[model samples]
Target: MKEFDLIKQYFAQRGHVRKDVILGIGDDCAITKVPDNQHLAVTTDTLISGVHFLADAPARSVAYKAVAVNLSDLAACGAEPAWISLSLSLPSYDEAWIDEFVNGLYELTEYYSVQLIGGDTVTGPLALTITAQGFVPPDTELRRSNAKPGDWIYVTGNLGDAGAGLDILKGNIEASAEHRDYLINRHYYPTPRVLAGTSLRRTANTGIDVSDGLVADLSHILRASGCGATVHVDRLPVSSALFDTVGAQQAYRYALSAGDDYELVFTVNEEQRGNLETSLANANVKATCIGQVNGYTGQLDLRLYDAKYELDKDAGYEHQF
Candidate 1:
């Protein structure tokens, strides 16, 4: 099939979309209107075969992840996701593959009420690029530069499941049937903390998504805020399945360095603790206080049972150029 045919066959539907999207798919460029008094938030992410996911993995999952990771960034910025554009590159077209891939993409967009606006298709070693845009109230968007030294640090959802999931997929280790499926699903279908991020926007001092593990992502905030942190390893939230399957130490390693979890790590002031709790409650999400912001510069101090813990500074995934 030709490129335009592929797009029309699988992705041309746009009957229902947010009022902001004036023009979507099939146009030379999509048009959107930002709400008055709100700031436009945009984020983009690219997923490459092998590096980001297993080459033989399900196409639907890849599409879902491509949209999800970009939306995750919008969520981190405390924006309400509204639209997405996709650029998919493949070696060749397969009707069945395209169908499944589009289905996965629609599933997430439908859930979030996000519209697919415009994109391109090309022949290449498989890759998927997504650009998502949203709106956040002016002066209230979460950022990496606002954390204060006395603020309490918190993280939404458990950490390291996706990291463990990836290792299992790569066959480096074995897992029980139930645990394997759970972890694998966690890796493939990550839940972006959109609601939680929105809820925390007015209260959070600073925030970021855990795309590259806790330490690395949090470091972005620390560096931007010009502050340091003390993250308690003991406070790291790991699923019971992870503890039972991989034991504590390995779980700790993955929680600290394994990337792709997409959870939100944020800080709240001591006085705003009540407000933070109330916001998470309204969002029906759970968050754990993992540590505190400190005075040290660009430092990440890991604590284990009250003592300073150490790990590879190279922890977490950094795309090697």
Candidate 2:
């Protein structure tokens, strides 16, 4: 099938309709209207086969991740996702694969009440790019640079599951079928913390989505905020599946260094922490306080009882262009 035909058949108008969309697919550009007194938050992510996922990864998973990761970015900024534009490149026109991909992609966008705008499809190495747009109230959006010293650090959900999932897929680890499936599913279908992020705007001083390793992504916050932090090794929320499958030491490493878990890492000062916790609790999110911001500049210390260790800067997967 031709590229345009493939896109029209599988993707056109699949995203849920919203009043703000002036024009969606089959146009030179998708036009949208931003509500009054609100700011638009936009983010884009590119996923490549063999790099982002296994070459044989399910098309549904690939499509889902493409959307989830970008939505996670919107969540970090305390925005509600409203629109997405997908640019997909496929090596060949496989009907079943295309159907599955659209099903997964549209399922997520529809769930979030986001509309599909416009994009292009082409023949090439398997890759997908999504540009997501969200909205936040004017003059108050969470940012990585807004964290302050003495603010407590918190993360939603357990960490390292996705990294462990990848390890399982790569044949680098062993586990029973049930445990393996759990880990693999976590890696493939991550929940973006949109509601939690929105709640954070009222309490969190700064935040980021855990796309890279916890330490690496936290470093971005530290650098931007011109501060350091003290993370407790014992406080890392290792999932039971990961802990049982790989034990404490390996689980700790994965939680600290593994990526692809789309949880939120945020900061709240002592004064606002109560409200923050209450808000997240109301939203039914599981969160834990891991540590606090420190005065040191651009350094992160992981504390385990009486001992402290500097995280290896290169520990996580660094996407090299």
Candidate 3:
């Protein structure tokens, strides 16, 4: 099938879209109208074939993650899904691969109420890129720079499952069937906490998604907010399944430094603690108070059960060599 033909067959179907879209695929460009008094937030992410995933990885999962990662960025800023454009770099045309990939992307766009707009495709080494645009109320968008020294730090959901899952996939460890399933799911289908982020926009003083390790990602928030933190290791959330399978200490390590957990890490002023807790409960999300923001400059200190550890100032995942 021709490239445009494939796109029309797989993505141009009306059933695959939700509202707020003025135009979809098949156009030279997607025309959109942002609602009144709303600010648009845009983010783009690229997943290279071998660098981001194995070439043999399922095509559908690759597409889903390609969009999901970009959407995760929009959610961190409390933006509502609006539109997406895709760029594809392929080694060859494989109808089966395209079908599965479009199916997964369509499913997510439908769920998030986003529209598939316009994009570009070219022949090259296998790679995928997604640029997603969302809308948020003016000045109500959450940011990483608003946290104050007296604020409390909190994170949504457990962390490190994805990293553990990757370890298992790479044959570095053996896990039970249940543990394996849990880890694999974590790796494949990470929830981006979109609803939680939106709800907390007005309340959270600082916001970030855990794409990098928690300690590292949270440090971005700290740097932007110009405040330091003391994260209580005991307060970091970890799944019971993790402890049963990976052991407590290992689980703690994973929860702290393992990346790809897409949960939200945020801060709220001490005076708003009660309101923040109530808001999170109403949203049906778990929000754990992990620590407190301090006036210390440029440092992250984590206090475990007995010992304290300070993270290397420059530790984080970087794709470039």
Candidate 4:
């Protein structure tokens, strides 16, 4: 089928449209008017077949994940997703596959109240790129460089679920049916902590999403803020599903080094911790204080009982290309 035919038959007008969007798909450009009091925040991500995802992955999951991950970037910066543009490069257009994909994409965009905007679809090796735009109040956006010494480092939700989930997919371990389903879902669908990030905007000294492993992604905030951290390995939260599927050691490794959690890792001051918790609680977000920022001149430490260690290396997924 032709490209426009494919969109009309399956992909066009598939999601909710927010009021602020002046134009959506079928336009040369999607026009939007940002509220005068708000700042626009935008982020983009691309997923390629056989690289970011398996070749035969579900069409729905692929579509959902493409927008979801980009929204996670928005969440890290405490932005409210308002619109998104999709660009798909494919060998050929297939209406059935496109329908399922658009359905999945619509599900997430609608749930988040984000509108579908403009993008270009081309013929090529399979690649899906999405650019999501969001809004945050002026001067209230969270930044990786804002953390300071003595700030309490925190993370929303449990870590290592996606990492452990990937291992199960590779057949690295045998698991029960329930365990397999749980882990697999963890890999396919990661929840972006939008509410938590929005709430932390006024309180968090710095913030980042745990797209890479916890240790690795948190280091971004540390490096940007010109500081170090001391995380308690024992305090790292591992989900019950993870512990039940894989033992503690494997789960811990996933928590420390496995990627794709899409959770928020942030820093707040000691004195404001109670108020921070209250804010998160109001947003129905759970967060844990895993560490504290140390002085800029000293090395970061992860205190394990009486011992400490340094996490100063490329500790995340290595992508080639």
For each candidate, what TM-score against the reference? Answer: 0.97, 0.97, 0.94, 0.95
Clashing pairs in 4: none
lDDT of 3 by residue, 1-321 (tens): 367866677667754554566776788877778888899999999989767766667888888888888888888898887888999888888888888888878778888877888787777898988999998998878898898998999999888787788778878777899999898778777777888888787888878899878988898988987888899988789987777778877787778877778899989997778888888899999989899899996677899864796545554544321
TM-score-based ranking: 1, 2, 4, 3
Candidate 4 at 297: error in angstroms? Answer: 4.6
As a TM-score, model 1 comes out at 0.97
RMSD of each: 1.5, 1.5, 2.0, 1.9
1-321: candidate 1 lDDT, tens digit per residue: 589988877788642488888887897999988989989999989999888888888988998888889889998989999999899998988888888898889989999999999899998889989999999999989999999998999998889999888889889778999999999989999988999889988899988999988888999999999999999999999998788779998899889888889999999999999999998998899999999999898988899998989887676686421
lDDT by residue for model 4 (1-321), tens: 477766555556567867788877776777789998999999999999878876777888888888888999999998988889888888887868877888888889889998878777789988899999999998989999988899998999999988777777777776788878888788788887878878988888888888778877888888888898888877888888888878776776788888888889999998888889999998889898888998763356777664775443565675422
Per-residue lDDT tens digits for candidate 2, residues 55-126, read 888888988888999999999999999999989988988899988888889879889998888899989999
Superposed model 1: Cα runs more than 4 Å off: 14-16, 318-321
Model 2, position 271: C-alpha lDDT score: 91
User: Scored by CA lDDT, what does every candidate get?
Assistant: 0.89, 0.89, 0.82, 0.83
True-structure lDDT of candidate 2: 0.89
